[model samples]
Target: MDFEKIQNEIGGFSRYQVVVITTVAWLAFSAGFGTQSAVFISAIPKYRCAVPPIDDPDVYPSLGESDIKNYTIPYDTATAEYDSCNRYDYNLSSCQGDGDLSCVTFDEDPGTIPCDQGYHYDQTYYKETTRTQWDLVCER
Candidate 1:
C-alpha cells in the first residue's frame, strides 16, 4: 500500500537516474533564474529629457543637469515626478535672451510632447543596455 515501500522493492534510483535528476534540477533552477531576469533586461531606468547642452563655459560651469532638467522638463506637482517622455517646447535662444539665468518650471501644457532629441538615464546600476541604448522611455 505504501508507494515508498513498493518503489524500494522495485529498485532505488540507479546512478543514471541520479545523474538525470541532478541535471534536470540544475536546468530548472537556471531556467527559473533566467526567466526572472528577463524583465530587468528591458527595465526602464529613471530618465529625463536630454536637452541641448549649453556650450558657453560661463553658463555650462554655472549650471547643473538638474537645472536644465527643471527648466526644460515638465513636472507634475501632484505626482512629484517629471514627465518622463515629454519636454517643454521652449526656444533656447529666447530663454537665454531673457537672462533670468535661473531654472523656472512651467506648468505642463499642450506643448508637452515626447522628447524631441532623446533621454538621459541613470547609469549607476546598469551599463548601456537595451533600454538605455534604445532610449525606450515614456511612450517609446
Candidate 2:
C-alpha cells in the first residue's frame, strides 16, 4: 500500500527512474508553455486613435505627424497619455481657405467623440498583435 516501500522493494530510485520522471516532467512543462503561448502572442499592445490623412493638400496645408496628433488626440489626465478611444471633434473647414495649418480647430470644452476612424497601434514590441489584426482596442 505504501508507494515508497513498494518502490524500494522493487529497486528504489534508480537513474532510469530519475531520467523517466524528469523526461515526463519536462514534457509537461514544455506543453504548458505551448498551450499558453497565445497569451503572449495575442497580447494587446499600446494603441491610440488613427489620425486622418489630409484629403486635399491645396485646401488644407500639410501638417506633420506630431502636429496632427497633438491637434486631434485629447490628453487623458487619468492615464497621463493621449486617449485611445476618443479624439477631439475637429473642424477642418477653417483650414479650407487660409494657408495656415493652425487654422484647424476643435472644441476642447465639450467636444470629445469615440474614434470613428480606425486606430494606430504601437508595434515597437509586437509588429501585429490581436489588437492590431482585428481592431480590438477601439471602442464602438
Candidate 3:
C-alpha cells in the first residue's frame, strides 16, 4: 500500500533498456505493416487477353515450296486471321504469323513494330517467349 516506493521503482529504468524496448517496438510495427501491404497487393487480379485460338488450314496453311515469299500478312488478333507464308525463327517472326516465335532463332527481337497504315505490334508475355499480334481491330 506504499505509493511512493512503487513510483520510485517503476521510474528507475536505464537508458540502454529504454532504447532496446523502443527498437523492438519499431521493428514489430514495421514488419506488421509490410506484411499487410504485400497481402493487399497480391489479392488484386490482373487483366489478360481473351482471344480464341486460331486453327484453320486454309486460313493458316503451311508455306509452300516457293523460294521467295511475298509480303507476309502477320496474325491479326482482332480478326483471328493468320498468314501462312511468313518464315520466322526466334528473331524476326511476326506475331500475326505464328505464336511460337521466340528470340532463340531468328534475329528479329520481340518488341513493337509500327507500320504505314497505323498498324502496330502488340507485345504480350506468353510462357517462355514474348508474343506479338496486330493491334488493329474492327469496331462492333
Measured over all alpha carbons after superposition, the RMSD of each candidate to the real structure, in angstroms, is 8.1, 8.2, 14.4
Q: Which parts of model 3 have CA positions greater than 4 angstroms off?
A: 1-4, 40-46, 49-140
CA-lDDT, candidates in order = 0.68, 0.69, 0.36
User: Model 2, 59-106: lDDT tens per residue?
Assistant: 446555466567777887888788778877665445443345554454
Instruction: Write out the backbone clash pairs for model 3.
Output: 74-96, 75-96, 75-97, 90-102, 90-106, 91-106, 91-107, 91-108, 92-108
Backbone clash pairs in model 3 (N, Cα, C under 3 Å; residues 3+ apart or in different chains), count = 9
What lDDT does candidate 1 reach at residue 44? 68
- Candidate 2 lDDT for residue 140: 28
Q: Please rank every candidate by lDDT, starting with the best.
A: 2, 1, 3
Q: TM-score of the candidate numbered 3?
A: 0.26
Looking at model 2, report the run of 10 residues with the lowest lDDT sum. 51-60
- By summed lDDT, the worst window of 10 consecutive residues in model 3 runs over 44-53
What value of lDDT does candidate 2 attain over all alpha carbons? 0.69
Give lDDT tens digits, candidate 3, residues 1-140. 68778767878657877899999999999999988774343321211222111122342355331211222234557876443322222223233444332222334533323232322222343221111233223220
Candidate 1 structure lDDT: 0.68
| Candidate 3 overall lDDT versus native | 0.36
Of the candidates numbered 2 and 3, which has the greater lDDT value? 2
Structural RMSD, model 1: 8.1
Question: What is the descending TM-score order?
Answer: 1, 2, 3
